[model samples]
Target: MRNEIALTLQKALRELYNIDWQIDTSIIQRTKKEFEGDFTLVVFPFVKQARQSPDMVAQSLGDYFQQNLHCRFNIVKGFLNLTFPCQVWINFLKNNYTNTSFGYFATGNSDVTLIEFSSPNTNKPLHLGHIRNNLLGDSVSRILAACGKKVIKVNLVNDRGIHICKSMLAWQKFGNGETPESTQMKGDHLVGKYYVEFDKHYKAEVAQLEAGGMDKTVAEKQAPLMLEAQEMLRKWENNDPEIRQLWNQMNEWVYQGFAQTYQQLGIAFDKVYYESQTYLLGKQLVEEGLQKGAFYRRDDQSVWADLREEGLDEKLLLRSDGTSVYMTQDLGTAQLRYDEFHPKEMIYVVGNEQNYHFDVLKLVIGKKLKKEYGPRIHHLSYGMVELPFGKMKSREGTVVDADDLMEEMIIEAQNKTSELGKTDFEDGKASQLFEMIGLGALKYFILKVDPKKNMLFDPEESIDFNGNTAPFIQYTHARIKSLLRKAADHQINYNHQSFNEIDLQKAELDLVKMLYEFPQIVKTAGEMKSPALIANYAFDLAKEFNRFYQETPIFKETNEQLRDLRLHISQFTALVIKNAMTLLGIHVPEKM
Candidate 1:
């Protein structure tokens, strides 16, 4: 659509200038309704080439569109307004509205891309931070897939480390083999509690031992829980049957808990890579890099990568003990994925804090291969999702658990439904609606912001139904559905029906224009890799449709033919919104 508009304008300009020089028409702008045009073609850039005043260039273009082109045109303050023909826009909306693939990109043009996100440590249930990561990754993949990209969604689980040992130690000392069912707690939350318990007891034990005036290093190393956790890690690494059994059992519970939460939030991944598997791969990569001179060996026998030439400091690739740090595992994962898919691009949908880490990874990969064969690595750095008070702190226990947050949103949705006098819904209908509304609210809230901008997530302000929210869009859909059902009962078909353009008022024309722009919105969102753009576009369309609904009468029109045509348009617009919202990973309930 952008290309079409640009081409048309360029042709008009060429005719106006009567020139043979190459002309570019990329300086078009969207104009305000009150400013007298739908799009403004800036003529200031042409002033030098055309050797004419900006105002004269604008007038000439406006005159060209009116006299030589098929569309109407007007000029305001050295800006040419190109108003597309009503029939052109009407045809665009009708064609797109009737087709199932109206707002999506052309098929067979998708690039193979890998998207990695939602990397959580095994020590705790997912918190608000992970929620942002999950949504961004899932939404990015969806957006790319919508744009006809062969997107591979992956997750790297951080399941091994001292953090894992903390939970293991706590469970060993205090669990007494209590299962999640026995404790009546969600598996991940149950495990997380033990992790917190371990910290408390371990700190106390260390303090008590130190008070006895023992050597600092000896006292710390001999701390009972610390030593036990270390021993457990060693046993686990050595494949000790008893420790492996316990490790697998606990991790199974955590996986089950994560599955339930993911299902509720509508997130999925094509592959799951655990640190237990990838960390060793990371260590192996360090050894390979050292042999290849991609990395250097320190005096302390640690492996290092000097990225100072890349404007980064030296980084520890492998510890003196030959263990992988966070970065080593990332480099290994990149190689593993490339070996698997050979993707044209790899997008790590991580947080802004890891920007520097990815920079190092790219540098190391470049050095190791001595060629730019690392596939296009992009660190999709998103900002923190904060609360009204401040950042969510896990150790402070003030973090919003994803499960708990979803539950709260569900309850709020249920209460809203009841307030709307929807208490008579079927047995499971309310539960179904709760999931849709809750998840929709959660996704829409997050995706509505620019992914790079730090956003505040106030629990109280997250799910308003009256504003530019998921529920507002959902309600618009529900209303259209009800109206469509009524239209069906009345035996209406507007496919062949026609209406005069004279009746197209401002609100009506605004709606038609908004509906016509859905494809462009989807295209822009895909190109920019920003789902928030579509979110904003969806809300804008819904708002305009609602206004049109309040002011324009579809059912009450005296002309049956015209009434039927308007009804068809309304139904089609509703379908477009429903489909667009789905691309953004939002669900619309029938009655919200």
Candidate 2:
């Protein structure tokens, strides 16, 4: 509908006398309710080219519409108020209401996109940070798929590091083989607790060893627990039977726990990339760069990439001991991904703290590889999720555990539903509704904000029943479904197929306008890679739907034909809301 109007005005401008410029129809905005029309196209941009007053441009466009166009038009100052024929809107609603796909399809141009996110270290359970990363990555993959992009979602598990050893050493020294089942705890939290225990015990042990007439350096180097963990890592790296068995056992438990959380959150990946597997990837790349004269080797045999001219300092690609750093592993992953999918685009849905890291990556691609791929590499770096008290600190144990947070949201949703007297639903249905509501709340709360801007998350504020919230939209869907069921019970049919016979009211017009804009909203959100646009559009549709519901009656209307028309409009509105919500990775429950 928006495109139709824009093109209509574009043709009018082109055919107009003394108008030599391309018409800028980009300003076609929905006018306020107080105004006379549904959409207002401002013609002020063409004043310079038209060499006439804004009012003259507007009048000329209005005259063209009245004389040459099928749609009605009016000139309100410098804006063109255009209204479609009543049948145009009715036909649009009729088509959308009956269509299965809601008028969306893949663009047929398939480009593989590798999305990397949720790289959680094994030392701790998933936290709020992981939640944000997972939501963004998962939502992005879904959106890209909706737009015909073949997206491969991958998680680069940071399974090996000092962090992993902390939990392992703690378990070996103090756990006494106390398994997750033996301790009756979730595996990740169980592992995480021992990680905390290791820090306290290691600190006290270091102090005691130092007090026994040992220098700080000697005491630190000779710490028994630390040395034991290092030995464990070395043995595991060498594929020692017993150590490898223990590593597998622990990581399996952690994976089981992670699987539960991911399933609960509706997050899934096509492939998993483990750092332990990919850590050696960058070494050969660094060596290749050196041969190609793209990198310099230090006196101690460390490989360095010179990026100072690019406003970044020299970065060590490989350590003096021939160990790969973070950059090297990334380099290897990129090459490995190219070999696997040869993605036209690679997006890292990492945190904002790694901005400099990605910058160095782009620099390396330009100077070292000298490869210019059309599909751009994007770092979808979202801001850190801060708590009300301050930033989420994992070491201090102030972090919001993702599993616990999701559970709390479900509980909150159940309580709210119960308060609304929604207990009459069947047990299975109630449970499903709760899950939908809870997950929708979580996804909508996260995606509504600009991904790159820092935002405070108040759990109390996050799950709200009103004001651009998930439940509010869910309620709108429920209400529409309820109305449809009622209409069916009353045996009302809308097959008269004549829309011009009924009088068009304000509420009906508002609903029609909102429904007409869904395709435009989908296109805008997809092109910008911003789900917030869809979120906002969903809320706007809900608001307008609610207004129509309150002001107009469908089942109670005197004329069965008019009532059926309104019902079809309501049905189309519900269909659109459902479609938009799904794009944001949210579901609409029939009841809330």
Candidate 3:
């Protein structure tokens, strides 16, 4: 409808002033609620082109729309407000109200988009921060796929690093042959326990060295525990048989634990890449850089990329002992991904702390090494997820465990739902409901915030069945489902009914208009790479439907046509809510 109006205005300009104008759809926007129209056109840009005052241009355009398109318009200053007739909205609803996949684009686009997220280190289990990364990456992948882009979700495990060595050393020294089966703990958590133990003992060693008059920095480097961990890392890199076995065993434990948590959160990856496997690729890149004069060898025989000319400091690619750094593995991983998928875009969903790291990655790959696909690298850098008290540290064991948090969310959901007297669920159904509400609350709370901003997650607040939380939206869906069931019980057949003759109430029209915006919202969210857009759009649509439900009668209406139209509207709204939440990697329960 907005497109038709824009085209009509363009024709008006050509007819009246003999001026050919290109109409941009962006100029036409939904009119603000305070305004009296459905759509608003900013005529200021056209004012100069038409050689008239802003108000005159708006009035002329409004008159043209009112005449040609049968749209009623009210000119407010320089804005042309156009309101379409009821039949226009009816036709739109008749066409799209029954579409099960209303807002989703058909798939099969060849533009591959590879998203790398949930880059967990084997030294610790997934934490609150990993939750945000996984949810963001997963949701964005779903959104892009909905927008007709072929998306490949990938995970890169930091399995070979100093951090992993710390955990391995701690386990070897203190584990005393204890295993996940022996201790009955999750594998990642068990390994994380040892990682913290290593930190505790390492701190003591550092303190002892400092007491002997060594500087704090020197004491830290000279700590026996630190030296042992470094040696373990070297041994592992050298493929020492015992170290290799230990490394593989511990990484497998972490992977198993990670799989359980990912299942709980409903996250899956199309491909999993490990640093141990990809780091060699990074070494090859460094060697190539050396041959191309893009990298220099330091006196200590370490390979370095001098990016100071590109506004970055020299980055260490290989250590003096010929060990690969994180950047080295990342370079290899990037090339491996591009060569495998040929993705048009490669997004790294990492924290904002690594902003400079990704910057260096792009610069080194694009400018220094001059790779053609280097410019496709995008760092979806997001802010940290801090607790109310402060930030978390993995080595210090201060991070919120992902498994523990998920269990808490489920328990909270159970308590809240029980309090609401919704305990009539059948056998095993209540547990399923709890999982849905719990996971829904977590995903919505995290995804509703812009990805670029840091968020403080309050579990109790997110589980509430009010405000912008997912429970509220889920309950709204449940309510609509109940209504549909009630209609079925009453033998109301709304399937083939004609809605053109019925006049839509204000609330009903508002909801239909909101529904009309879903495709656009999905498109905007995809382009911006932000799930917050879809999250808030679902909220608004639900809120509007609730208002419509309260003011407009569905089952109570005496006119059969009016009742049928209301029921159709409710059904369509429910489909949209379900679809939108699905894109956010959240499930909405039919009964919540």
Candidate 4:
């Protein structure tokens, strides 16, 4: 409707006033509630260009709209409010309510987009922050796919270097050959435990040295555990048999544990890259940088990039020992992804702490190294996920582990469902219901907030059957489904009835108005790269449906035509709720 209006207005403006201003659909907005139209267009912009007063411009556009379209319009001040007839909305529902592929526009020729997220280290388990990263990446991928982009979800596992060596050394000394099986723990958790042990013992060693009257900085460097971890990293880098074997075994265990968590969280990656395999590519890039003079070698033989002209200080790509830093590996990985996918865009779903790093990366790779794809690297930088007490620290083992948090979500779902007196489901399907509700709550709570904001996740608050949480939307969907089933059982068929035959109530028309906004909502959400738009859209739709359901009667209505309209709208609402939730990687149950 906005497109048709925009085109008509553009033609009318050129023909009437000889103006060539480009008008778009964005100018045609929803009419304010106090007005008496479905949509409004502020004509003040054209008042100056068209050489007319505000009232004159509104009147002229209103007349043109009435002639070119089926909408009726009225001008108040400078606002041209247009209201479409009943047949317009009736056609909208008839054409789309039954179309399962209504809003999704992805095709074979869509632009290729690669999103990298859920990059985890082998030394630790995924924490709450990781959950947010995974959810955002997955949701954005889904939204992009809906917008007709060929999306590829990718993961990079930080599986090597000093961090992993610390865990490996700790397990070697203190694990006493204990395995995930022997300890009855998840492999990632088992490995993470030893990582915490490494920190504890390393700290103790440092403190002992400090007590001997040594400076704290010197004590830290002289710590035996630190020295061992560093030596182990060097041996692993050199492909020593013993170090490599231990590295491979511990990494395998971590990978297995990661798989389980990803499955539970409904996350999947199209491709997975490991730092261990890609570090050599980083070294090659460093050598190339030196020859191209994009980077310089210091007296100590370390490779650095001078980026001061770009308003950033010098960056270290490689250490004096010729070892790669995070920037070096990232440079190679970015190039590697381009070589493999040739994606139109590469998005790194990382925290905001890396904002400067990505900035330097773009300048160094795009300008200095002159990689064409460097300018396409987007850092979807998000703020930290803060806890009520403070920030979580992995070394202190205070971070909320993903597995443990998921388990807690399920328990919360179960309790909330039971409290709401919604536990009448079959015993066989109860667990499935709980899992769906549990994960749905978790995903929605995190995804509903704008990805750039720092959000405090309160598990207890998310599972409430009331409010904007997933459970609320899920319940609304379930309620509408129940209404549809009842209509089905009673053999009340609305399939052959044309909704244009009825005098629709204001509430009924309002529901249809909300439903018509879904496709546009989806388009806008994709363009803005925010799932919060879709999340809020679904919540508002559910709230409106509840309002409409309360004020209107379906089977209880004596008028057959009105009853059919109610049932048709109910079915449509349920379908849309399910569709929107699915885009957020959430599932809505048929029964609450």
Candidate 5:
């Protein structure tokens, strides 16, 4: 519709003023709430050329648009406000009410987008921080796909690192041959417990050494546990049989735990890359960098990339012992993805702390390796997720485990649902509804905040059924569903052409406009790469529907056509709410 306005202005300007005013469509904006128009156009730009006052110019342009487009107009200073006739809006509702894929689009060309997220380390279970990454990545992927992009979601597990060895070494010394089956602990959680134990004992050793008058820094390095962990890392790298077996065993346990969590979150990876498989390719890329003089090696034979020109500290690509760092595996994994997918863009949904790391990566890949895909690498750096109490530390076992958090959300959802006396479903159905509401609340709260801003996750605030929460929107949807069911029970079929000519109230018009904006909302959200836009849009639309519900009568109306029009609008609003929530990886229940 905005395009129609812009293109109409293009023809009007050319014919009226002999001015090829190349249709600056961006200037055409929604009119202010105080105004009487649907859209406003600035007329000051044509004033001098037309040899008229700003008011006269606006009046003339308004007349030209009203004549050409059949929309009524009012002029405010140099702004031309145009409102289309009721038929235009009613026709819009009639044409689109039944189309479920109303907002989906077909693009000019197919573009492949590869998104990498949830790069969990084997040393710990996924925490609240990982939840944000997973939600952001999954939601963005959904949004992009809706916007007509071919998206492949992937995960890179940091399966082999010294941090991992810390857990391995701790399990060897203090685990007493513990297994997940015997202990009834999820594999990942079990390994994470040992990781915390390693830190506790490692800190104790450092403190004990410092008690002997050794310097803190020196004691930290020379602690017996630290030394042993480093040795275990080396042995694992060298593929010692016992070390490899232990590494594989523990990682398998973690994988099982991770799978369960991913299922709970409804997240799946199109492909999973492990550092153990891709580090050699990273080593190959480093060698290529060295050959091209993109990096330098010290006398200790460790590879480094000098980025002082860019005001960044020098980055180590390889250690003195020829071991690879995170960058090494990342380089290899990125290249491997490019080779396989040839994506137009490769996005890494990592935390903001790795901003510089990705910057350096792009610099090396583009400036040094000079690879074509270097320019394709993108880092979707997002802020951390902190709780009301403060930040969490994975090493200290202070981070909120994703599994436990979801469980807590489900329990809270049950309590909240029961309080509302909405527990009338069969036992199994009631349980399922609790999980849906619980997870929906969690996902909506996290995704509602802009991805670039750190968010405080308050479980209590998220599970509420009022004010910008998922349950509110979900309940609104369920309300509509119940209304439609009741309409059926009364033997009132709403499908008919009579409602198309039915006069619409102001609230109904507002809902019609909101429904029409769905496509544009989706397109804009995709362009901005923000799901918060969609989340909030869904909330606002739900609120509008509720307002319309309260102000307008449906079944009780004396006019059959008017009541059917209201029901049609209500049904369409519910569909939009469900679609929008689905894009955020949330489910809207039929009952709440």
Candidate 6:
């Protein structure tokens, strides 16, 4: 409808002033609530083109629309406010109220986007920081898919490195062959415990050497534990039989642990890449760069890329001993993805800390190596998630475990749900509802904030049943479901009814208007890669529906047309809420 109006205005300009204007260049937006119109057009940009004052241009355009387009307008200074007749809104609702896939665009074969996220290391279990990354990546993938993009979600596992060797060495020396079955602990947690143990003993050894009249730097290098871990990494790189066996065993444990956590969080990946496998590709690329004079070799047998001319320092590609660095592995992974999928865009959903790393990656590929797909690389750098106290350290074991935090959320959900006397749930249904509310709260709270900003996640605050929380929106959906069921029991059939002649109340009209914006909201969210847009849209829609429900009587309305219209409006609002929440990877329960 807005497009039609814009086109009409463009034709009017051509006819009135013999001017050629593009429809897209015209500015049209939804009017503010304080204004008395459905849409507003800024007339200032066209005032000079029309050779008249802003008010005069607005009046002329308003008159044109009122006469030809069936739109009434009010002039507010330089803004021309336009409102359509009641039948226009009524026709909109009648046409789209029952659409199951209202806001989602269907993807075609040509649209392909590959998103890499949740790149977890096998040395530790998933932590709070990992939670934020996984949620943001997963939600962004859903949003993009909703906007008609063919999305391929992938995870790059850092399975082989010095960090993995640290945990392996600690377990070999301190652990007496204790397995996850023997200890009854999660596999990732068991591995993480040894990683912390390695750190503690390494630090003690350094401190002891420092107390023995040795420099701190030299002591750190000479520490027995640190040297042993480095040797282990070298042996693993050489594919030593014993070392390879241990590495495989420990990595399997961590993978099992990671799978459990991913299942709980409702995250899955289409492809998984191991750094150990991809690092060789990077090494090959480095060798090629050296041959092409894009990289230099040092006297110590190390390889480096000189990016100083590009404002970045020289980056190490291969160590003097022929081991690959993180950058090398990333390059290999990027090349592998491009070869396999040839995606239109390759987005790395990494944290803001790696901003410089991705910059170097792109520069090396684009300028140094001269790869065509290098410019397609995008770093979706997001802010960190912090608690009220401060930051979390993984080595010190102070970081919150994703599994533990999810369990706590479920317990909190149970307590809050019981307090609200919503405990009429049947045997197994109560547990399911608790999981829904708990996970919903966690996901929504983290996603509600803009992805570019750091967020403080408060579990208790997020689980509340009021004030812009997921529970509020979920409960609103449940309330509408209950009302629809009641209508069904009372034999109120609204499916075949015609609401074209019914007069919509202010609240009803407001809701229809809000629903009208869902498609645009989805498009904007996908363009910006922000799930917070959908999250907050769901909140606003829910708030509007609650206001409408309070002011309007549905079941008791004596007029059948009015009651049917209200029921259809209620049903449509619920559909929009469900669809929007789904984009955030959140599930709203039919019964809260």
| Top model number, lDDT | 6
- After superposition on all CA atoms, how large is the RMSD of candidate 6? 1.7
Clashing pairs in 1: 110-148
In angstroms, give how far residue 533 of model 3 lies from its true place: 0.7
* Better-scoring candidate (TM-score), 4 or 5: 4
- Judged by lDDT against the true structure, how good is candidate 4? 0.88
Q: How close is candidate 2 to the true structure, as a TM-score?
A: 0.93
Model 2 Cα lDDT, one tens digit per residue, 534-560: 888899899999988998877678887
lDDT of each residue in 525-589, candidate 3, tens digit only: 99999999999999999899888888877878999988888888899999999999999998887
lDDT of 6 by residue, 1-592 (tens): 8788889888888887777887772277888888899989998878887899999988988999999888899999999999999999988888898999999998877578999999999999998789889999999999999999999999999898899999999999999998999999999999999999999999999999999999999999999999999999889987899999999999999999999999999999999988887878898898899999999999999999999998999999899988788888888888899999999999999999899999999999989999998999989989988766677788755687899989988998899988888878878999998898888888888899898888775533544546898989999999999999999999989886577677888889999999999998998899899999999999999999999999997988999999988999999999999999998888888887
Give the TM-score of each candidate.
0.93, 0.93, 0.96, 0.97, 0.95, 0.97
lDDT of 3: 0.89
- RMSD of candidates 1 onward, in order: 2.5, 2.5, 1.7, 1.5, 2.1, 1.7
Provide the lowest-lDDT 10-residue window in model 1.
18-27
- Which stretches of candidate 5 lie above 4 Å from their native place? 16-26, 43-54, 107-109, 311-313, 458-463
lDDT of 5 by residue, 1-592 (tens): 8889999988887777777787665788878767888888988888778788889877777888888899999988888899998778878877888888888777557899999999899998998899999999999999988999999999989899888999999999999999999999999999998999999999999999999999999999999999998899788877899999999999999999999999999999999988888887899999998998999999999999998897888999999989788788778888899999999999899999999999999988887788998889989989988777778877655678799889988998999888877758976898888899889888998899999999876644544556898989999999999999999999999877665466677788888888888888898888778899999999999999999889887878998888888888988898899889989999998877
TM-score (C-alpha) between model 3 and the true structure: 0.96
Put down candidate 1 lDDT per residue, 27-94, tens digits, no spaces: 65566667765667877767787888888888777776666556677776677788876666566555
* Candidate lDDT (C-alpha), each: 0.80, 0.81, 0.89, 0.88, 0.88, 0.90
Candidate scoring better on TM-score of 2 and 5: 5
Please provide, for model 4 over 433-468, each residue's C-alpha lDDT reduced to its tens digit, 9 standing for 90 to 100: 888888888888888989899977553444354698
Query: Model 6 off-target regions past 4 Å?
Result: 299-301, 458-463
> Using lDDT as the measure, what is the rank order of every candidate, best first?
6, 3, 5, 4, 2, 1
Model 6 has an lDDT value of: 0.90
